[model samples]
Target: MDTRRLTQYVICVCVILTTVTLAQGQIKRCFACRSRGALGDCKDPFRFNSTHLVPGVKDEPCASGWCSKRIEGKKDGKDHDLAIERQCLQRSPPDDKERCSEALVGHRKIFICFCYGDLCNSASGIKPSFLLLFIPLAFQMLSSRF
Candidate 1:
């Protein structure tokens, strides 16, 4: 191949490789579960379970997933609750908690915390500290490239 053609081919290959790597990296696969029935129902509203969906296998797509829910109520003369509804959501809820109101599920006071990232809805629930750390790194990468 001529010099110009050869240079173009190398650039194309690099671009393809980088695109594939970045695409794979962005697919935030998280532990999939729900607090319904026998799924991930929190029997103890104050505690969180660490049950993940297959340790190393990224089974589900979590592009915009979050996992934070707590529901408490009384049943059968005992206090029943569901702590962390650890799972993945296809898209985020439409309203923020401030604007999002609560509802009564048969005397259960359900509290939901919406956040973003892989398994980020855990106890921490999308920490600003992480965003603070991520912003500078992203800025440096983009600025350095320019």
Candidate 2:
């Protein structure tokens, strides 16, 4: 092949390879989504919360397919639980605690200090607002003793 033609061919091949790599990188998924037939009841209301469908896939790119729950899984006036976050979706029924626990499983990938309900205790470090709320009560107790 001529030098000019060979250079063009090389450029075209590089472009194709870059495009494929970029496309694959765009398909990342959340760490919580579980396998269920077509989102099942594992979804959230779009108007109130941002949702990630097919959440727990390992290297899938995140995509926006959110809708305002055009349908309901109501059973006797109660909404159906969508297993959109973690294995809670695959649960049989009436296992609310399991769902909650899974939801709070924390990013094990994050530091252990931040994993799951670490903020539940006083030792987690108090917010100034919360300490402010107790100031009045402390003052009242001191005044009563006086």
Measured by TM-score, the strongest candidate is: 1
Model 2 worst lDDT window (10 residues): 110-119
Summarize candidate 1's per-residue lDDT along 9-117 as a digit string, tens digits: 6556556665765665576655444444323433333233234433322235576654444434434353334333445666667663322235676766765555555
lDDT of 2 by residue, 1-146 (tens): 86566556655655566576556445433223332334443333311112322333322222421111112222333334322332112222342221112222343221111111111111122233333445465445445544
Q: Which prediction has the highest lDDT against the true structure?
A: 1
The lDDT of each candidate is 0.48, 0.31
Candidate 1: TM-score? 0.41
Candidate 1, overall lDDT?
A: 0.48
Q: Candidate 1: where are CA atoms >4 Å away?
A: 1-25, 33-60, 74-83, 96-102, 125-146
The deviation in Å at residue 68 for candidate 2 is 26
